[model samples]
Target: MTRRPATPLPPLEERRRLREAGSLTPDQLAARLGVAIGTVRAWESGRTTPRGRNREAYAKLLAALAESPTRTGAPGSAPAGGPEEPDAAVVAVGPAKTVSGGRRGRAAAKPSAFTQTPPPSSPFLPFLPFSPFSPRVPSWAPPEEEDPLGPVSDLTPVQAFDALYSFCAPSLVRQAYLLTGRRGLARESVERAFQLAWERWPEVARDPDPAGWVRAAAHEWALSPWHRFRPRHRRPEPPLSDASDRALLKVVLRLPPSYRRALLLHDGVGLGLPDTAAETEASTPATAGRLLHARRAIAARLPELSDPRVLHRRLAELASTEPLRTAGPPAARDGCERRARFWTRFALAFVAVLLGTTALSLRTPPAGHEPSVPPGETVRDVPPRVAPGPLSEKQRKLRAKLREELLHGPERLAPQPR
Candidate 1:
């Protein structure tokens, strides 16, 4: 195949505008150009520019978008002027598949993790829209009918949560696994993250990227420094079955956590550098540096995996092929509810105990102002209680004489009284 000549693409901001003005989403453009959505996002975010054939195709697509009549604003967005990104106009457009009917125009983009909800229910993944694949990607029971990505109000909160869970959990588990080699740790991370999302569903549902919100939580938990101390995760899980896969993962694990994370988000998970950096809590440049370092390390060990696309496929494989399969959405939701109930009961019990203690103290307070004994005191003037020692023989003889002279004593006693 002949390589397309280098084409001068529009300015980065213009690229974003071109797509937005055309009512196109990242996934739409990705599908059209035969590239991963992250590649398109990277192009728009100015992290990495397209090259060779891709550059040519992108330039052509943008030129077509420029020529196409501009709509007032993209679907699901305010007309003309509205809040957009820092350097670009705000236009939210969903997957172009909404136009499958050829009438509704572009539907608003589906919520993120829509990676299989970031914590899909199993190891054998049913890759969501975000999964990297050719336009002809296959999965079981395409959700076109149920439309899990439909408007928030279309489904009850429970249904919506379950939808998010079913879609995102499996992918999230895989992602968490790649982040931390321990399979159980990965499952736990996704479970904990989803549980947290349920606790803050209000905030999460309103978020621009709810799946990403859970993804961030899961990844953070999986990569936490504290996990090393856990008895279950003290040592890494056994390596992957394939020798090549094991080698690739070994290289991945060898990198610093930050660098490994950047690599996973950017190359492994097909996220834009900006997203990767934001999720990893690093500056864009810093994220880029980490990604670069990570890629170089991988390349040094395994040359064939240098290409971002290949690396992504390998990472996905490594993550998905694990023996661990997570629980379903119902299970996740139930776990969340269970945990909430337990904590609620615990709090109520604690409050009741505290109140009871307070009431008991109030009911039986000190009756009187009972004097409290000081710590150190001794009586000074108190006499000894024992009578004087037995009188000598002289005292005994005098007592006998007094008894004999009782008559005379009466006169003496009477004189004394007078």
Candidate 2:
């Protein structure tokens, strides 16, 4: 039986807008969604649309992107310099119609007002007009005559690390801060996570959820025991201008790590349930339960905030606070130092394995001295025999008698007598 294809999602412009709001290039968006870069481009160009799970994931991602503070500014405000009336273009979701004129007429009809402008604070200022997240032109195109986008595909290890670090450092630190109440501990965790990511950039760059991967690592490091021994210099806490928000933060910190992490990722970061599950390495249902439990626990503690909406708003406000220390890309370690650390760990592991093998070998019995066999089992050991010499007369007589008994059965001789 033939099946009808799913309806294509809302127009390419919507997808492009969401991508901009999320501050993600097509490649980065594809990586996050576990889709190919071509697929994201196709969707944005209205060449094709996502379906089934992909479609659902795309919707959730757009919703999450819309809510993210980094891209969308404050909760109620539109993105900086975004269109005042987004609904007017809702009718343009279907395939684009061919214009009645040649290329010149089409170019003339294009609205320059809607053209993307690069953010003033962007570090890659020289390449601002060719920004990957810009919807006006494909990011894969050459930026200039001399500086082609070839290097993007063949980025050096340091460049890749820097790109990932610049995009995600602040968000990672914020997540770490939520996991561990202390800003110092949070910074330590985030730095450690970025350092590890730098070491494994090749693998991480190809990961479907690079940000989530780093966030998970940061969470684990924040909860690690190694930090307990380090001297802590606590920064002054953000003033509790509102007592209710302060109280909520206290309650959130007291929850179990699982509950707290689930809650923070869902309500605090505006991640969908599946994304939260992926970050926490839990099943969707399990993550949902954790979130439910966390909300209930918080509500129980403060009856006034029992409404789900109120609790969620409070959590978002708490999570939006700036970290005590600003986060940046982790400094690249010297190749010599990295190699030394690797060899040191490898040698220690090798020595431990050798010791274990030796201990096991000593506990085993030597060949030919194994334990006794159980009943009905036979041992087949053949002892070495000495070379024979000439037989003695008595030995010869005994051998002749045994031959005679064998030739004429002893039973036949005894029967004849009976």
Give the per-residue lDDT digits (tens) of candidate 1, residues 7-101.
Answer: 55654445665776776878999999999987888777545667768877888888897776443333444334643321112212112222222
Query: Would you estimate the TM-scores of all the predictions?
Result: 0.56, 0.49
Alpha-carbon deviation at 53 in model 1, angstroms:
23
Candidate 1 weakest lDDT stretch, 10 residues = 131-140
Candidate 2 lDDT over residue span 242-350, tens digit each: 5765677788888988898898777655455766787788999999999999988988899876775455444433544433454555343444247659999999999
Candidate 2 wrongly placed segments (more than 4 Å):
1-154, 225-242, 307-309, 330-418
For TM-score, the strongest prediction is 1
RMSD of 1: 17.1
* lDDT measured at residue 368 in model 1 versus the true structure, 0 to 100: 81
Predict model 2's lDDT versus the native: 0.59
* lDDT score for residue 275 of model 1: 87
